[model samples]
Target: MAAEAIDRAMGALIGGALGDALGMPTQLLSPTRIAELYGHVEDFVAPSADHPVSKGLPAGAITDDTEQALLLGRILVSSGDRFDHARWVNALLDWERDVKARGSYDLLGPSTKRAIDAINDGVPPEQAGSSGDTNGAAMRIAPVGIMMPPEPLDALVAKAAEACRATHNTSIAIASAAAVAAAVSSGVAGSDWRVASDRAVAAARRGATLGHWVTGGDIAARIAWAQKLVRGKAEKEAIRLIVDLIGTGVASQESVPAAFAVLEVAQGDAWRAAVISANLGGDTDTIGAIAAGMAGACSGLSCLPQGRIARLKGIDLAEVRALAADLVAARNAKAGSGKEAAA
Candidate 1:
C-alpha cells in the first residue's frame, strides 16, 4: 500500500517489458498467421524476418514498446518527476537517433515519427502532436501512473495528459493514457481490479474535460463496451471478440479498448494477461505491454516469473526500480508542498 513498495513498481516496469518481449514476435502479424506460425504462444519467441521493424530481434528481446517506456521513465526521473512536453519530445528524438545509430530498425511509431519530424521542420513542440491519435502515449504511460497514489484522480489525469502531449494530444489519446495511468496508480495503491477499473474509467472521463479542444470519440464509452463484451466470455472467445469488435490495431480507439478487454478477460492476472495479449495479433506488443503493466501493478512482482524477467534485454531492473522510487518520492513531495500551501 505504501508508495515505497518496490514490488509493485518492479512488477509494473518488468511486467510491461516481459509482455513486450513475449509479444514482439507476433506484433503486426495476423491472428491466423500467428496461430499458423507459433500456435498459441506461451513464452518468448524470436520475431520473424517478415516484419522489417522487428527483424533480427532474438527471443526475449523487447521492442519499441518497452524501450520508449523506459525512456519515459528515465526522463521522469531526470526531470524530478516533472512532465515536460518539450523535454519528452527531445528525449524521444534522441532515443530514436541512438537506436538508429545502433543499426536497429525497430523505430518510432507513425504518429510519433511524424510529430517529431514536424517539430524538426520548425513546428513548435506543443503544436506538433496535434495530429497524433494513436495509443503510443498510453503504451508507455504506466511509469507516470506507478509514481502516483490512489487519491487525486484529477492530478493523475493531468499528468497523464502532459505525458501524452509530446506525441498524442487528441482527447482520445490523452484519455486513453489517463485510463491506463489511473488503473496502474490505483492498483499500486492496493485497490482491487474492479476498483481500479472504475478509477480508470473515471479518470479518463475527467481527462477528456481537459482536452475539450481536441476532437475524438469517447474512450470511456469504448472501454465500457469492451468491458461488457468480455465479461463472461471464455479466453478464446474474448480474444475473438476483442479483435473483431473492439479491435487490437495501432490506433488509440482500437488498442486501448482491446488492452482493457484483455486485462478484464485475464481478471488481473499479469502473466495470463501478457500471454493473452501476445497471441491477439495486431499491435500485440503494445497491447500486451499496456495490459500486463496494469495487471502487474495490481498483482505486484510475485505474479511474474523471475526466470523470464532475468532474460529480458535492454533493461536493467534495478535501475528501473530506483527510478520508480525516485518518481514516488518526487510526486509525494510535490503533493505535500501543495497540501502545505493549501493550509
Candidate 2:
C-alpha cells in the first residue's frame, strides 16, 4: 500500500510536468492560430520567436506552472506541511529574480505579480491576494492536496486556502484551487476517478465558504456542468466543447472547469487528457498541468508515456517523487499524533 501510494504521487508530479512541457509552446495562441501553424500539436515543439510568453524557451522546458509547483513542493517538505504565505512569496520573488537574470520574459502571472508587489510595498500577507480572482493559485496547488491528511473536508479546505491566499484570496480562486487539491489528495489515496471528482466538487464548495465572500458563481457547480458537456461525446467534439463552451482563460471559472471537463472526457487517461489540455489554446499549460496532475494521481506513474517522460527537461522527477514521499511521512506523523491526542 505504501509503495502504491508513492507511485500515485510520482505519477501526479511527473504527469503534470509532462503536460506543462507539452503545452508550453502553444500556450497563448488561439485555436485557429494553432491549427494554422501546426494542424495539431501532439509532440513537444520549441516556441517560435513569434510565440508570446515562451518565445526563446527551449523545447520541452516547463513554464511558471511547473516551476511554482516544484517550489511549493519544496516549501511543503521544508515547512513540515505548514504553508507560510510570506515564505511562498519570498520564493516566488527569488524565482522571478533568477528567471529575469536568465533573460526569460516569462516570469509571473499578472495577479501573482501584482499581489507580490503589494506585499513588498507593506500590504499584509493575508491582504496581499484579496483581490486576485485568477487561476494562478489553483495551478500550483496540487501539492497541498497531495500532502494534506484525508477526511475533515474543512481542514483540507483550510490548508488549500493557506497555500493559495498568498496570491489568490478571492473565493473564486480559492475554491477552484481547493477543488483541484481535494481531487489530487483523494486520488493519491486510492479513490477512483469519479470519487475523486466528487470530492473535488464538494471541497470547492466548502472552500468557497472559507474565504471572504465574493459574489460569484459556484465553482463546484461549474465543474460539474463542464463535465456533463463531455459525457457521451466523441473526443474531438468534447475538445471543441471545452474550447468553445467552457473557455480556456486565466480566470478560475474558465480554466479550472476546462481542466476537469477534459479529465472526464479522457476518463483519466494521463496522455490523452494532457494532450487535450495542451491543444485547448489559451491557458494551455495550466489547464494541462491540472488535468494531468489528477490523471497521474489516479493512474500512477506507469500510465504516463515513456517517450514524453524521457524528454522532460529542466525539472527533476526524482526530487518531485522524494517531496511526495516526505509529505506522506509528515501527514502520517500528524495523523498519528492527532489520534493519540484524541485517546
Candidate 3:
C-alpha cells in the first residue's frame, strides 16, 4: 500500500510536469497555428522564437504549471496540512521574482497576478481572490489531492478551497480546483477513472457552493457534458469538439472541463492524455497538466514512458519523489488517527 501510494503520487506529479513540458511550445498557439508548425505535438519540442511566453525554452522544459505545483507540494509537506495564506503569498512572490531573475517570461497567471497585486495594495487575502475565475487554481492543485484522501469529500473540497483562496476564490475556480483534487485523490486511493470522474463531479458541485459567486458555466455540469461529448468520438473529432465547444482557454469552466474531456478521449492513458491536450491549443499546457495529473493518478507511474520522463528538465526528481513519499506518510498518519478516534 505504501509503495502503491508513492507510485500514484509520483504519477500525478510527474505526469503534470510531463504534460506541461509537452505543451510548452504549443501553449498560446491556435490549433491551426499548431498544425502549421508542429503537426501534433507528440514529443517535447522547443518553442519557436516567436512563441510569446515559452520562447528560448529548451525542449522538455516544464513551465509555470508544473513549477507552481511543485512549489505547492513543498509547502504542503512543510506545513503539514495547515495552509498558511501569508506563506503562500510570499512563495508566489518569491517564485515570480526568481522567474524574472532567471530572465524567463513565464510568470503568474492573470488571476494569481491580479490577486497578488491586490494583496500588495492592501486587499485582504481572503477577499483578494474574489475576482479570480481562471484555471490557475486547478492547474496547481494536485498536491492537495496527494496529501488528502477522497473519503469525507467535504474535507477534501474545503482543503482545496483553502488552497485556492489566495488566488482563485471564485465559485468556478474553486469548483475547478476541487474537481481536479478529488479526481487525483480518488485515483491515489486506487479508484479507476470512472470512480475518480464521479468523485470529481460531486466535489465540483460541493465546491461551487463556496467562494465568492461568479457567473460562469457550471463546472460539474460541463465536466459531465465534456465526458459525454467526447465519448466514442474519433480522436480528431473529439479534439475539434473540445477546442470548438468545450474550449481550452484559461477560464476554469473551459479548461478544467476540457481537461476532463481529454482524459476521457485518452481513456485514462496519461501519456496519450498529455499528447492530446498539448495539441488542443490555447491554454494547452494547463489543460495537459490537469488532465495528465488525473490520468497519472489513475494509471500510476508505470503508464508513463521512462525515456520521455528522463528527458524532462528543470525539476528535481529527487525532491518530487521525497515530497510524494512524505505526503503519503502524512495521509496515512491522518487516516490512522481518524480511525483511532472513531474507535
Candidate 4:
C-alpha cells in the first residue's frame, strides 16, 4: 500500500505471472473470436479447443515469462554487477534440463547463443551481449530493475543492453530492451507512469541511433492509431488490430513497439491493460508480461488484484518479497558508501 520500490517489483512480477496465466487459455484467440466468446476477461479463462501449446496446463501457473525473469533475478543475486556470462549460459542449460515450461536454453535467440558460444571460446562478459536486438533480452529484464533501484534509470538500462547482447546486439533491440528495463527501474524507484514513460522514452531516445522520426514518433503514431481502433470497441478487437497492424516477434521493432503501445496508452492500469495486450494472440504471454510489468512497476503492488497474489508458482511470495527487499538494501548500501558505480 505504500507504493515502495520493492513493492513495485513484487507487483510487476505478480502481474507478469497473472497476465501469463490469464492469457494462456486464450493465447491464440483472435479479437473477433474473443468477442464471440467470453468478453473482457478480468479473471482466468479456461483453455478452449484449438488453442496452441499446453492447452490444459491448469490456470495460475506462469509460463516462461516469470521463469526467465526469476532466472535473471537469481543471476543478479549471485553475481551482482559482475555478471558471469559463461556461468549464466551454464545456469540456463541447467534450468532447461529441469524445464518447468517457464523457458528453455534451447529457446535462446541467435545473438545470445552466439555470445555464449563466444564466451565459451573466451569472449569477455562485457562484450558478450553487444550484438542482440531480440525480445529475448527484454523478456527477462525486470529483475535488473529490482536489483538496482532509486537511481537514474538510464544507467541500469545500459546494463540491461549489455546483458541482452549475449543474444541480440542490434541498436533497435538494445534501445527497446533498455526502454522496458528503464521503465521498470523508474517505476520501482517511485516515479509516476507519465514520468516513467518519459524517462523510458528519454533513455531509449538517447541510447538509440534512430531519431524520433524512426523510433519515437512512429511508435507514438502506431499506439495512437491503435487507441482509436480499440476505442469503444472490445479489448479483443483492439489487440487484433494492434497485432495485425503491427506484428509480434522477438525482433525489437515488432515486439517492442507493440509492447510499448500498450504501456504508453494504458499507463495507470495494469489488469485492464494486460487484457488488451494478451488478446494480441501472438506471443500473448510475453506481450502481456511486458506491458503488465511496465504498468505494474509504475502502479506499484497496490494495483494488483489480491486474487492473483494467491496464485503464484515456482517461488513463494515471501522469497520474492525478500529479493525485492534485498534490492533496496543493496541500493542503500551502495549509495551510502558512494560505491554505486555504473554497471
Q: How well is each residue in 1-343 modelled by candidate 2, as lDDT tens digits?
A: 7678788888888878888888898889988888777788888888878886888888788888888988987887787656767778999999999999988777899889989999999998778888888888888888887777657688889988988777788899899999999998888888867888999999998888865667767899999999998988998899899999999999899999999998898899888887888788999999999999888988888778888888887887778778888877766676677788889
Candidate 4 per-residue lDDT, tens place, 1-343, comes to 2237678888777767776766666555665666566676667666665455535456665666677787777777777667666667787666656764643222444656676777778876556556654567777778776666535545565666655645555566656666777778778777876677666666665447521222323333333344355455444455665777777655566666677667655655778667766666666677778878888888777778886668644457887777767665665554555553532
Give stretches of model 4 more than 4 Å off.
Answer: 1-3, 28-40, 48-51, 100-131, 209-240, 313-315, 337-343
Error of 2 at 248 (Å): 0.4
lDDT of each: 0.83, 0.85, 0.93, 0.65
What's the lDDT for candidate 3?
0.93
Q: What is the lDDT of residue 200 in candidate 1?
A: 88
Off by over 4 Å in 1: 1-4, 212-216, 338-343
RMSD of 1: 1.8
Query: Which prediction has the highest TM-score against the true structure?
Result: 3
Question: Model 3: residues >4 Å from true position, as ranges?
Answer: none
Candidate 3 lDDT over 189-304, as tens digits, reads: 99988899999999999999999999989999999999999999999999999999999988898999999999999999999999999999999999999999999999888778
Each prediction's TM-score against the native? 0.95, 0.96, 0.99, 0.81
**CA RMSD of each candidate after superposition:** 1.8, 1.4, 0.8, 4.5
TM-score (C-alpha) between model 1 and the true structure: 0.95
lDDT of 1 by residue, 219-291 (tens): 8888888988999999999999998998889988899989899889999887888899999999999999999
| Candidate 2 TM-score versus the reference | 0.96
Clashes of each: 0, 0, 0, 14
Alpha-carbon runs more than 4 Å astray in model 2: 341-343
